[model samples]
Target: MSAEEIRRAAAERIEEAEDVRDELCAALHGAGVVLPSLRVEPAAYADERPRPLVELGRCNLRTARLIAEALRRGGAGA
Candidate 1:
């Protein structure tokens, strides 16, 4: 594919990854689990490489426990 096509695809992938991040954040919120650093990793799309990534960055211990509990109770993860 052309450079423009590759760029467009990467852009689309990044957009989709961002959408997924938002959805996950919202879902976690509904489950009372908040990860302040949740985001799309810029590096994933930096070189227009394949596959974008949604990053759930570090959260505090309390938040980590909350997420674990939520998962245990089959909350948002279910």
Candidate 2:
């Protein structure tokens, strides 16, 4: 309705996105992998709906191998 309401809703969505990203980071940490560039995608805020996105950015080759190994070992858990 109001601009304030819209901003509040958008903030909530951003918080949810950050929460999801944090959860994923914790899971990856448990699996002995870390995504140094992991973060919420800033572009999502520019959208009409403001549905935030989690961005798993680039990592080093060693980190890539770690993720791959975790996935290969943990299957759905990774």
Candidate 3:
């Protein structure tokens, strides 16, 4: 499938979830997109931060764009 198609599929999967990031990663993996190693961490200053923090070790630009588009389509902005 094309990258756009993969991205859309991933977004649809993510949208079905109550929590998105993990599901998104799984969907991408299922689509044969190898994501970089990463960790999700609670914001150090939760009172000051609006969202959780994620640390991505390394990712290709195309994969990053796909993830961003998926998040946007899923109503979860990246």
- For every model in order, what is the number of clashing pairs? 0, 0, 0
TM-score against native, each model:
0.85, 0.82, 0.35
Give the local distance difference test score of model 1.
0.86
The CA lDDT at 21 in model 1 is: 97
Which candidate wins on TM-score?
A: 1
Provide the overall lDDT of each model, using Cα atoms, as 2-decimal numbers: 0.86, 0.89, 0.58
Q: After best superposition, candidate 3 residue 16: deviation in angstroms?
A: 22
Which model is ahead, 1 or 3, in terms of lDDT? Answer: 1
Give the top-scoring candidate (lDDT).
Answer: 2
Q: Give the TM-score of candidate 3.
A: 0.35
What TM-score does prediction 1 earn? 0.85
CA RMSD of each candidate after superposition = 2.3, 2.3, 15.6
Q: Which model is ahead, 2 or 3, in terms of lDDT? A: 2
Clashing pairs in 3: none
> Where does the lowest 10-residue lDDT sum fall in candidate 2?
44-53
